[model samples]
Target: METGDLVRELRTARGWSQGRLAAEVNAACGTALTREYVSGWERGKVRPGPFYLRALAGVFDVPQAALDAGRAPGRAGGAAAATTAALAPSVTSDLLGLGFAARLRGGPSADDWEARLDAYGTDYMSSPAADLQRRVAEDLVVVQQQLDAPAMWSAAARLMTVYATTFPRQESARSIQWFRTAAEAADRSGDVGVRVWVRGRGALALGYGGTATGLADLLADQALALTDRPSVGLLHATLGKAYAAALRGDRPAALHLADRARRIFDAAYDPSARLSDYSIPAWRMNGFLSLLSARLGDEKQSAKAREAALCELPERLPRFVTHLELHKGLTLVRAGDREGGLACARAALDALPQERWCGTLQMLMAEIAA
Candidate 1:
C-alpha cells in the first residue's frame, strides 16, 4: 500500500478523524501541524517531512521504520502491516474489533470496559491525555445508555475518577458533575459500597477545588456513615476530611483525621487486591498524608510519609509517582527548599500531557516563583 493508504488505515483503525489525529500529533510532537496538513498527506498530495513522520510514529506508537517502509509487491501493505504489528495489544484490539459499528451494536462487555478503565487508571501519568479523553468520551455514551445495566454504576464511577484525576484543574466543574452523576448512578443501582466509593472520590475532588472544603467534609462523612467496618473507601473519605480540615486551618482536626486515616489504611490495605473500594492504594494514601502534614506544618511527619510512599511506589502507575512528587515538592517548599521544590513541581508537570495541564500545579509553580 501507498504511504497515504497506510496513514488512512491506521487513523481509521483508531477511529480518529483527521483533525483529531492532527491534534494528537501536535500534542505529542509539540508542533503546530494542522488538519489540512494531515489531509494532504492522506491524499498523497504532499509528502510528510522527516519531523512529521517522526511525529506520526510517536502518535501511532510505532517505530519510524514502520512508517517509512512502503508496500512490497507480494505482501499487500508493508508499512501498514508493520505498524499494526508494532501497536500495543489493546490498541490492536480496538483497531480490529472496536469501531463505530461495534459501538452502535451496544459496545463491549462489562469486563472489557473494566479492563480499559483499569488500563486508563494505571497509565494516566504517561499516556497522552488526548487518548484518555477520547476513550472516556466514547465509553460515556455507551455507559449512559446502559444506566440500568449492572455494570453501569461502576463504569460511571471509573469515568468520574478519570476526569477528577486527569482534568482536575481545567475541568473542575465538569469533574464534580461527573462525580455527582456517578454517585447518583450508584444510588440507583442500590449498591451502598459503590455509593460510598463514588462519594469518597467526589469528596477528594471537592477538596481539590479549594472552595468546597465544607462540602468535601460533608460528602466524606456521608460516605463513612454508609460503612459499618473499616474499609479503603472509608480511609479515603477520612483523608478527604483531613484535607478539608487542613484547608480550613483546623490543624488539630486535620492531624486527628489524618491519624485516623492512617490507622484505617493500615487495617484495610491489601497489596494483592485487584481493586480497592475507593480505587486508591495505601501508598497514595501516604502521599495524601504527606500533603496534609505539610499543610499542617509538620515537616518531619510529611517527610516520613513521603519516604513511605516512595518505598511503596508501583511500577506501572506513573500517576502515583507524579502525585508523590507533587507532595514532595510541597513538603520541600515547607522546608524552605523553594528552588528544589519548584524543580520537583516542574518534573511532575513534565510527566503529564500538555492538554492535562493542571491548574493546581500552575498555582504551585506560581507560589514557588513568588
Candidate 2:
C-alpha cells in the first residue's frame, strides 16, 4: 500500500535505471524534473505535486489511477510475497535455503547435523504467509493414491513443515487442522523414524507459538529415542528438544543440549569423510547454534559461531540465515562495538529488506537499538 515502496519495487523488478525513468518524466514535463524528485518519492521522504502525478503514471508503465490505487493502507503491494513466504516453510525455499535439498534426501551427518536441524526451527515454526490450500488439496488427492507408508510419510513430513508455518499465520486453517491428519498418516506408515520426524516438527510448531509448549519436549524426547545416530531425524529431534528447553526458559539445559549438538556437527570434518557425503548441513547448524549462543550471553562463542555462519551462508538461502547477521551485530553491541553491530544488523536487514519472519532477530535488534 505504500506507494513509494511499491514504486521502488516495480522499478527494480523492471530493471529500469532511476536516471532513465527520470529522463522520461522530464521529457513529459517539458522541463527538467531532477532525479532528486524521483528519489524523494521513492524514499517516502516527500510527495510529488499534482503536476508530476500524470507523468508518474507513464514511467511506472500503468494507468494514472492504477498508480494511485491502493495507496491508502500502505504495504499492500509487498504483502503478497511477504504473506506467501510467511504461510509455508517448505514453499519458502528461498528462506529454507540449503536445508531443503537434504530434507528432500532425508539425511545428515552426526557432525553439524544437530545444528543444521536446530537452525531450521525458526523457519519451520513461523508461517511464510502463503495460502497453501491448493497445494495441500492436490497433495491430499495424490496422498490417497500413495499406498506406501514411506511415500506417504515423506510427503507428510514436507506438508507438516509447511503447515507448521501456516498455523501461526492462520493463512491456511484447513492445513493447520490437517497437521494431525498428516501426523496420523506418518504414524501409520510404521516407520518410527518418519513418525518421530513428523511429530518433532509438530511439537516444534506448537512450541514456536508457545501453545502446547509443555508437550513439545515430550514429543521431541520421544523423537530422540526413536532415531538412530547420524540420521536427519536424529539431528532434527535434538534441535527440537533444545528449542523446547529454550522456550521453557531453561537456558542452561538448552545450552547443554546445544553444545552436544554442535559437537555432533563438528565431527563431520573427519579427514576420511567427504564433506558432501557426510550429509551434515553446515548452514543450519551454524544458524541455529549462533542465534542460541547469542541468546545465552556467550558472546565469544556466539561471535565465533555467527562469523562462521556468515561464511557458510553463500551456499544456502534460509530466511533465518539473515539473523546470523543480526546475531553477530547484536553480539558486537554486547561486546560494546555499537557501530559495528549496527552496521552488521542494518546490512543483514538490508540484505533481506524486511523482518516479517525474523521475530527473534528483530527483537534482538530492537533491544540493541533501545
Candidate 3:
C-alpha cells in the first residue's frame, strides 16, 4: 500500500471529499493546502512533505508512522472499515461538497466574507424563517464555492448555524443534516467557542422542536463538558436540558436546571453587550425562562420572565416578541383563564406572519390549546 492509497482510504472512510480533506488538514495544522494539493497527494503526482504527513496523521487520528509504513493505522486494513461504520452518522455523504461549483477566481476577501456573514446574522434575527432560509442557502452556495482557506470555514460555520436554526419546525430531517454540517464546519474552523456554540444551539433547537429530548440532553451535556470556564455555550446548554426536563414532566429537575442556567447567564453573560448570533443575550435568556416557566405552570415566574424578555428584545426581532406573547397567553391559561388564554395565544399566532411560525412557537400554541 502506498501512502497515497492510505490517504485516499482514510478520507473516503470518513466520507470526505478532496476539498473536505484539504479543509480538515488545513484546520489541523494551520496549513494553506488546497483541494488541488490534496488531489496531487492522493493521486501520487506529488507526495505530502514531512509537515503535511504529520498534519494528515492528526486529521485522520492515526499514527504518523502509519503513513510512513503505507498501511492503515490499526489492525492491518480493518480499522478504517470499522471507523467508517462507526462514524457514518456524523460523516456527511455529500461527496461533491455542498452543491457548490468551485470558483475559478479568488472570491471575496476574508474580512469581506466575515462582514457578509455578520449581515446574514442580522437578517436572521429580523426575517421570517422560511424567507430567510432561501437567502441563507444561496449565500452558503457562494461561500462553499470559495472555501479554499481556513478563515472561510468560520464563515461557512456561522452561515450554517443560522441556516440550521431556520429549519427546526418545518423540516426536521433537513434541520438535522444542516446542524451536523454546521458542527463539522465549526470544528474545521479550529475555534472551540464556535464548536461549543453550534452544539448548544442545536441542543436547544432539538428541545424546542419537541422532537428528541434525549438527544437534546446528550448534546447539552457534551457542550457543558467542552469548556472549563463559564460561557454562553454552557448557559444555552443548561437551558436546553432544563427545557427537555420540563417537556418530560420532571418539574423539580427542570426548575433546578433552569436555576443553574440562570447562574451561568448571570456570571458569563454581559448585560450591556449587544445581541449575538453565537451567544445567548439577556433577552434570549429571559425568553428561555419565560417559555420554561410557562410550561412548568409557574405563572408568576413566567409573567416576570416574559416582562423581562419583552423589555430587552429588539423591535426588529418580532418572532421573539411573539414568543414572549405566547408565554403570556400560556401563563393566562395556567392561571384559570382558559377562554381568554386560548384566544390570546391563537391571536398572537395569527398576527405573526405564517412564514415566521417555528417549531417553538407551534409547540407553545399547542400547549395553550391543550
Best by TM-score: 3
Best by lDDT: 3
- RMSD (Cα, Å) of candidate 1? 12.8
Stretches of candidate 3 off by over 4 Å are: 1-102, 147-149, 332-338
User: Stretches of candidate 2 above 4 Å error?
Assistant: 1-137, 144-150, 166-181, 202-212, 266-280, 315-320, 329-347, 350-370
Question: Residue 339 deviation, candidate 2, in Å?
Answer: 12
Candidate 2 on 30-75: residue-level lDDT in tens? Answer: 3476777778888889866544554564344343443466242223
Residue range 1-370, candidate 1, lDDT tens digits: 7777777877877778999998776543335779998899889999877756665764664555656673321233443566567668887667555444455677667888778777775556556555666677556655665555767667776675665544434333334445555666667656777777777876765564343455577678889889856776677678778888887799888889877887887787777765332355766777777778877768788889888888877676565566667767777877789889888888887986565555445544554445
Give lDDT per model, in order: 0.66, 0.54, 0.74
Cα TM-score per model = 0.63, 0.50, 0.67
Worst 10 residues of 1 by lDDT: 70-79
From the highest lDDT down, the ranking of the candidates is 3, 1, 2
Report the Cα lDDT for residue 357, model 1.
54
Clashes of each: 0, 24, 0
lDDT of 3 by residue, 22-80 (tens): 87655433347899989998899999877677667646656566777788754445444
